[model samples]
Target: MTQDWNNIPTSHQIPHTRFLVDYFIKLPTQVTAFFLTHWHYDHYRGLGPNFQQGLIYCSPITARLLERITLVDPQWIVAKHNNEPFLVEHVQVTFLDANHCPGSVMILFQTPEGSNYLHTGDMRYTPDLKEEWKILNNICLDAVYLDTTYCHRRYRFPCQEKTIQRIVDIIQNSIGRDSHSNEIHCTSRHTLYLIATYGIGKERIMDALIQKGYRIYASPDKWKVLQCLEYWDSCLLNDSFTTEPCASPIWLVGWNRVAENVPGRLLPNFEALEDMLYMANYYRNKVNSSQHGLLQRVVACIPTGWTWQGNNREYLQEKDHSRLSVYGIPYSEHSNYEELYHFIAWLRPKQVIPTVSFSSSKRQPKHPFDHLLAGTQVKRAFLQKWLNNNPKESCEDDDKQSTQQLHNQPKIARKGDILSYFKASPFNS
Candidate 1:
């Protein structure tokens, strides 16, 4: 939920249960179990080495991170696998992959009274989510606690793989080499690539470059966290302190070291870039490489969904200075507007409760998917149209239609056709 750091509200508590997800500050006495979605600082803020709270439920990777990074008591932490149903105080709860980070999950709660609730803690919705056990089983949801971080229509961007490829292309092109070639040759000695990242996320970009035979330099603290992840390749990472500064052509810096993201603008952080250039030049001079002059060029790429400028024409935005250039690539771990729309439409939950706040004004902004919720006229009309169009169509006629139109038609023409229509719609694809 949209939590106020100063005073956390009771809205984080699930209905008909004493369990709390991603809320750990000044917890109530009635809390019997704590649920952690991931190892991000914002989600596990109040947890510490001295915490004496009850057991915390999370994924396996997150459990490892807690033991190593936060040093939370291992006795109080319970690790669970994805899609496994377990009883907590006689209530069945399951964890599903949230697809946001290493150990993020979407929690499902089923009570004895036949009520179902889903708490999606910072998730990126994908088409494969439709095949999850809960959705495939067609369980009637009582309420859905959704993550509305990028609920606006302007927040749409390309998929994660596309964005990663774009960043790799930028790096390869800047280094004066063909991206598809196995060999990378750069004539300029002053060129350096900087990738801005967070503590836990953005490993996909690093892994992509590593697969291309590029060495990356990271700090010891960052490397420690990376070792906890299951997919990290230790051969490609270099300890920054032990190795020379210019040993690797690419360096991973903090998120704010490349660009400063404000409300509606992203400006290059010239101060941080200047400091990096100075450090690189100093290290080069110490080693006496060619006894030459200082470096001149540095290219920094900041990957985030906020870089999207609401224009389909501009996938990558650039800003140029005299010696440094910054490129903001639209790489996000959160679902965009269209993804959110398709997910909600397919789930068809009875009621939706947004867990994020988008505005600071007295009057909050309107939700973008309000029209697609239950009981709305738009939903009614869409279901009605689907039922009327495919009432008595024969199997041969359905096969005769084009694949695009066939995806729009339901698989079976039955009494309650709305469910089949939604299940077979192109949006789910």
Candidate 2:
């Protein structure tokens, strides 16, 4: 399971992401362990007290972050690092850096039956990640659980570097306009630039801003989380920031206010960001027209892959006001359709299953895409290639015998399999 919003471990009535966790509690599913790919809330939020089935594992950094933020104890979440393979109930599990977010990982599991499975948890395929997967050439991958968040044809985006440059350009242009404005009565006022960000996953953009000498300000809780990330990569953030909006040129705003558009002007935290229109009105009312010029302008930029509308990257404006501007940049944490296609081609798994899925109407992987087509072509190609490579194992065999074949096949000879095959293996101990 990748990500589930509900924290109910026992309740089977939840999203598909929690299916495995929920199923384990209802039956003797023989689930030996629960593995977390990253510290994203959707991935680990459903973990409740009822989860006593197996050992839970996450990366060292993810473990630290979870412990600090949530009720998960340090002992409950075992810390695993990249390239370290451990055995649990005759299954060999290896962790690799996901290159998506801090402490994100991809898992490789080799069963005693000699079937190999690779599950990429919320990853962006990079050159470094490509190099890391080279270690798996010795073992053939039977199946791959891929992150196909942007599997559609329209999700063509440039590299992360280009997106970063685009973001920087937007900020610079806004500042340049303010600098070069020819107002008769000019006042020294700061423009409120809000960058919409989730809890994690935009550290690179922050690093770029920090490099250009901009301090990041967020809620106290989020600031603590940023501090934890800063401990790992010093360039990712700054030590100090102010909560006051006018004090900083750039503010890291949470997604709740802008996304939900919650009413009553109540911010979640004392320093929480509220509606930009409301804030703009507050500033506008306080402005002294007789004394000087414009008081403040609020600009909100959302960095996401859904910026393209009919093959062009443009900003879609809100209806209420002109001062409150929202721009979507072509920034993404997951691989696009072309990248996903190429990644699948490179891995050449016998079977490929998308780790993430969406309803027919909802294109929001996190947020909605302008035009989302269920790109069956990529999957068709994979299926065709897989069928060509392994003719003996047809789709019929895949449908009827895949799970049973994996479990019931003759166990490969190992040091402890003969002694502890039926009983609990000594690997976890």
Identify the leading candidate in terms of lDDT.
1
What Cα-based lDDT does every candidate model obtain?
0.71, 0.58
TM-score (all chains, Cα) for each model: 0.79, 0.68
246 Cα displacement, candidate 2 (Å) = 4.8
TM-score of 2: 0.68
Error of 2 at 56 (Å): 1.2
Clashes of 1: 0
Error of 1 at 254 (Å): 0.7
With a 3 Å backbone cut-off (N, CA, C), the pairs that clash in candidate 2 are 3-42
Q: Which ten residues in a row have the lowest lDDT in candidate 2?
A: 418-427
Candidate 1 per-residue C-alpha lDDT over 328-393 given as tens digits, one digit per residue, 9 for 90 to 100: 888888888678777776666766766664444343334444444554544445566698863444
> lDDT tens digits, residues 247-274, model 2?
4456787765454322111122212333
